[model samples]
Target: MGPKIKQINRRLNELATEWNSFDLGPSRRETHSFVNSSDVIGRDKDKENIIDHLKEPSEDGNIPVIPIVGIGGLGKTTLVQLVYNDDRITELFPLKLWICVSEDFDLPRLLKLMILSVNKEENCDGLTVESLQTCLRSLLNDKKFLLVLDDVWNENRARWIELRDLLRSMDGLSQRRSL
Candidate 1:
């Protein structure tokens, strides 16, 4: 009986260690839009293609959604960074906003990030969706803006439709650029 109790205790300790190992702690890592163009290799053609598409006026007059799809660590973000930093992009779109969506697709949070990008001094805490929408609309009221939603993991179509509808509702958002 004593030997059996000791074995059980040993297994419990092992299980405890396994559980501890599984905890990865809080994620502090985040992606930003800054990139070193010289260090980037072999993505020039892809970048140029995206730029060309961006330069072309939308025939249907709707927001263009350009998706750079690839598995993790395949330089999708890097390629986007290159495009974002291009001089042509700056000339084409007067306003550019980069938001790292990263798994959580909370609409208000996204709005807050956009507001922050435009106006760094804004206090977006505790703002309602309507307020955020009004604020965003005011900022982008009559401007051609480029918004990049990077590292998005949300696949829920309904949420996307809601966001799309919100953007479409805004006047002059017709000339918006999104990715």
Candidate 2:
């Protein structure tokens, strides 16, 4: 009975260690494709801007925050989507992460989404905002990540500040520049 209990404990430990290994999620090639953002119709300039920035991150390592700020229906999301799916840019950052921010930007939700975006198997159910932030800091502290905060409203300044603060906390994440 004692040996059986020890064997069970050893198996549990091995399973636990196995679970600790990172990333076990679904493939994203099935979704988040530029084809889904077909409504953007014509935004060649915007696509160019995104490409320019992405290119810098890939080739030159010097593209700024290239924000596509404008009123609604300007195809900001579509432009970014096109650039995101571009084959050239894909090879640049193999660690690509995409996050959606409509209006409300909750810290925990955003962090969990970011984690899941980067590491699909990341389980953030019991995690808090601080915990998630720490995880993001750990993941992005040394890595260069391109984040798209889509459809942000100009109304909520406080939430925006919080989100900005979290992003700013990242060391080498975003490089602010004009497009």
What's the TM-score of every candidate structure? 0.87, 0.64
Clashing pairs in 1: none
Q: What is the C-alpha RMSD of each candidate to the true structure, in Å?
A: 3.1, 15.5
Which 10 successive residues of model 1 have the least lDDT summed?
24-33
Over 4 Å off in model 1, which ranges?
A: 1-19, 25-29
Give the per-residue lDDT digits (tens) of candidate 1, residues 60-98: 756778998989999998999999999999888889999
lDDT of 2 by residue, 1-179 (tens): 99999999999999888877755543222224355545556676767766765665423433345667787766566677787777766666556666666655566877888788777777889988888988878876766556765555546778767866777776764442222
- For candidate 2, list the clashing residue pairs, or say none: 65-177
